[model samples]
Target: MKKTTFAFYRKTMLTMISLGLLLNCSALTFAEENSNTDENQQVQEEILVEQTEVLTEEVAVELQKEETVEQSNKSIQTPKVHFSIYFVAEANGEVTGQTKFDSLVSSDLFSNIVTAIPTPVANEGYEFSGWYWGNSYIGSTSSEVYSYFKRGAALSDLTITAKFKQVETPKVHFSIYFVAETNGELTGQTKFDSLVSSDLFSNIVTAIPTPVANEGYEFSGWYWGNSYIGSTSSEVYSYFKRGAALSDLTITAKFKQATPKFNVTVKFVTEGKGSLTGNVTFDSTTSDLFKDVVATMPTPVAEEGNTFDGWYLNGSLIGTTSQEVYTTLENTKLLESTEIVAKFVENTQAQDPITPPTDTPTTPPTAENPQPEQPVINEPVEPVVNNPGQAQQITPVAPEVQDETILDDATPEVINANNLDTIEEEVTPLALGHDSWSLINLVLTLGIAALAIMMVIGKKTTNDETRKVNKNAKVIGCITAVISIIIFILTQDMSNPMALVDKWTIVMLILGLVQVVTSFINYKVKENNEVESVNC
Candidate 1:
């Protein structure tokens, strides 16, 4: 009985070793068969690992060769085994349903089987950390292959909870404000305040607001603290950034006012009989300070005997012009309340005529019986006076007209019987021995001599007209010589012959010499021309 028991134990040990080998060989065969499929290959690799561990240290001692062969044949003949893989979601990620895995397995197959791995889903504001198997972390892979070999043969269900790290996106807010200068308003005024993401943290793309129309105001630019942000424009936008950890940002849009103007008044006045022309009503602003305004002065329409003088400003003479006066309105004095005047004066050349008294009778009175009614006339008169002793009623006679030019320098003289006849002979001489006879004789001599000289100079050859003119010149020359000599002789007084000879006598003598010289020259030229004509 002892020998039989020892032999039985040895056989049992041998069978267990053979079965363990068969199980290992069967696991390898399954791994080779499904190696082409990714899921199947993964499952087979897991099962091979578990089976190797068991076969290495525990499988031979547990089962005999016959039993191991029976389990291997049973696993190969049986259909696929069903198992559940549960995926739990976290951090707003997508939840996964239970996944089913089917595979042929043996008693050792459960130790080597691989579990189904679910695909990881994404979530905003959260980063995927890693996958979890119950309370333990599996891997960071999205679709990692899981093995349940360590769970043993009774393991059929798996619970994997998805893990995630909470994303910390700090919130930021920016405030925008519209600011204006004193008494200035803005148009399209607006403000902004909202939450922004760390990735989406940027400036606001908005144009700066403008001032209202006709407000005389202008928009400058947006400002952040003391620095300039941007200019004002309809198409422009502003940018806001967080520079500090706890930022308190506020921007301002600035505006400015317009410039002021001044008032100016000008007046135009006439000092003479003239008037102001061209926009006399001068009231304007200093906006056109660079330009000069002109005011034309009207021509002075003086009275009958008056003349225009010149233009004056504040009693001082500016300039003189007979046509029109022009004054510059740009003068600083004219910018304020001021006036300009035109002056005139009487013409000295325009004088009134002097007339004799009309009340005096033209008739002269006798010394013995002068009419009491006749006024005694101290001034000179032209009618004749009768010296009859009896008082005779005489008809009033018209006074003789006298030459004003001649009387301008001559004094009146009374004529008596003794000098009456001599005065009449001197005044109305029929011959050329009168008071103006010298001037007439000189004028005639000069005129005739000039004509003769012109004819001689102009003549190419001697003609009948030429000869006639020369003969007339000779006759006038001889008459002028004789008259001059006679006048010279008459001007000298025998009683006072040494007295200063009158200047007129010397002039007459000089004229006589000139006439004689001119006549001789004319005669010589005429003779030469006549000879030339004859020779031709």
Candidate 2:
């Protein structure tokens, strides 16, 4: 054989072998694909069989429900609401009524009420409080027609109880008389009547006694006879209850003599055509008596050749001296809100000049109560000319006299709402003179309650919009809590930690802390839930 022929045959055999190997691989792949297809078909058949079984079960359930409905339709009758009326507190009554879902709708509520029952009669010395349907007070109605069932309640077996309570008897009258300087002297300014009527064991409500302010004597604590009532603080509020034994309520405000000093207001009131050297209003101070208070009378500048006369006190001639200072303090009857007048006579001396006399007394400016500027406050007009072109000038009374504010820092404001008595007549100590504090407390309480309600509403919300709003609620709650805490801090004195332990402060603090903690916890829980959902 030839070499070329042999080579060609070998190459052909090699090609055939390669082709057969390729075909075997293709066949094995095809067989595997067929096996996979069979398995897939089997799985599909099983899934179809499960789906058919589910459908069949659902159909059966629906058929059963339908059959039940049909059977119920055959036996269905008119729906009647059941209600049982029972007497409470030894009362007797018979009540009967029928109510339906028509009463539940808002449009048909009033028209659908079946009020045909009679009210219960209570025993002697007892008054019916009200009827309780599902443990709710619906108010007491003593008419012949009474509602056996509540108007908008669902059709369920309800028990209505007619509650009765003992009749309240009138309280024995008593007097809450005050003793300051003397008995019943300042009580006339108060609306607290002598014939006071209250409950048998009600609390004793005393108006904040602040009107009796003495010049040198400080107001001490109130006393019942010799016994001292608690809390001598200037802003102390009463929370004491009245005793069961009725008697005259006498609260005495004893004043210790803090100082022997006194302030006297000396007004040079114009009686007979003369002008003072300065403003008519003046202030002078003295210890113990009027003689000690040497109030220098302003030199009188008489017009039309008139002469200055001697000063007179209560129509009696005081003295002709420039500085009239009495030796003994007891001789000077000077006290709070005292005024003095110096008269000017017409030509006491014929040779007197038009100007003020040389012997006329002149008041020197003191360091404490310095003479104010000549022009009055809010002055729209020119400076007052008492008499045309006179050396002594007097400030004319303003169209509206600007009241001067005299501050006694030693004495606290004891006048409460009872002084004006214009505020709400609430019985609580907090409302006595602290209406603003009370209002702040009320607002904080309502805000806390609202935040709690919002939290509960957002607790289980799942909608995207609703969840977003819920997330924002935490921020709002946090802000609200912070505000409450700030208010608590600002309102309290915080000197003694115990001083800040009032009812409002405690309640607000607790509520604020709880709000912050719960809001943080809620936010964290929601974040964790979101993370878990993302991971899933």
Candidate 3:
């Protein structure tokens, strides 16, 4: 800009000097060439000579600029570029401070250097935003302004624009919190990493985070309130949509301590016709790190004609009780395979089992009176006994049962294999060694008692008769007591040999003992009477 102004002033001053010299020379020439009158010559010379006072109204600055550019183009080889900055219709700022530079100049070498582009001013109620080329904001002034003009070929006319907006207002950012219980945590959350992105304020949406629980614990679920939501997995998508309002609220991820459940099984150890009580199995167990149980156990049930003996734990019988209300094995024990069973024993108090009559002859037949052969039972096989080929029925004795209670009358035995050739005789279904009473044994005991009663009734007592009667009674009582004791021992369960406190066996035993005592008393009385007779 300075160079252009200096050039203009210098050319104007030189033009005035050249005109002054020409005027002085032209006045002298006009006086020497024509020796006419001073007045006439003066008029002619006045027209020829130039005046010293110069007019100031010169060529237009725009015209001078054009002429200077044209002259420079012809002299210089550098290409020209037209650079400009202006405001668009929507711009709310002043357009005055557009950039200024020399109108006509060479390249950067000879041109006035431009420091920076002036920023546009904004109207009241508005603020200057930024300078934009088209759609991009390039700030108040272009950084490339230094080189913006020098590099472009073809007089670059860049029409830069500016934008403005209402005065500033405070802005708010978004954040969220996903907190877990003591033993749990969010899937990807770390102390350094944020729950939401870069503090986003709008259009905020994110995937629902999964919760993780430590060992021995389970992730109950995510909850907004204190109440449980009853879910263990995260939602398939985002919990909130893009347009939903978001805040810095917290959603709790709840967890629970894990517990294990065990399978419980209750078993019935009886088969004698009866209904059983108590569950066969239980799938309930404690929920803790340690093992302990406080549960009500199942009761024992016995069917009709049978009594509930007791409850059993594993394989051992709990005391001789009706039922067990709770578990016997607990606290670290019976944590795995546990078994509870209900034990039952049949009632044997009913007297006199009905007997099936056999077709045996009234008396043992001798060789003189040969009896016809008895019919075979269950088959047509002939008897193989050595004496008259007489076959005797022999039933097998049952073995002592264990673990499970066996039914006494399960099946009647045909005969012992060792005595297969013996004649098939009628046998009772109830065998010895079982807890039930044998029908044959019951009948034999009753017969002994009846025989003793008949012998004592309606008999006049002499000394010999009295002595014989007392002696016979003593022998009978001993036999009765021995037989009753053997039968009772045979019918006992070997598993619990000493548990034979049943009423039937005790009553029978006492009856035999009473008869023995009575015989002793009778003998004492007879001795006393004999002594009195001797004294008289």
Q: Give lDDT per model, in order.
A: 0.53, 0.52, 0.51
Error of 3 at 273 (Å): 22
Cα lDDT tens digits, model 1, 376-397, are 3332333323323111333322
**What's the TM-score of each model vs. the native?**
0.29, 0.22, 0.26
Model 2 lDDT per residue over 502-528, tens place: 457566756766776666666666676
* Per-candidate alpha-carbon RMSD to the true structure: 33.7, 45.1, 36.9
- Candidate 3 lDDT for residue 247: 54
Cα lDDT tens digits, model 3, 69-120, are 7688678766454443334524566645545443234543212434446666
lDDT for 365 (candidate 1): 41
lDDT of model number 2: 0.52
Q: Name the candidate, 1 or 2, with the larger TM-score value.
A: 1
Count clashing residue pairs per candidate.
Answer: 3, 2, 11
Q: For residue 395, what is the lDDT in candidate 3?
A: 17
Q: Of the pair 1 and 3, which is ahead by TM-score? A: 1
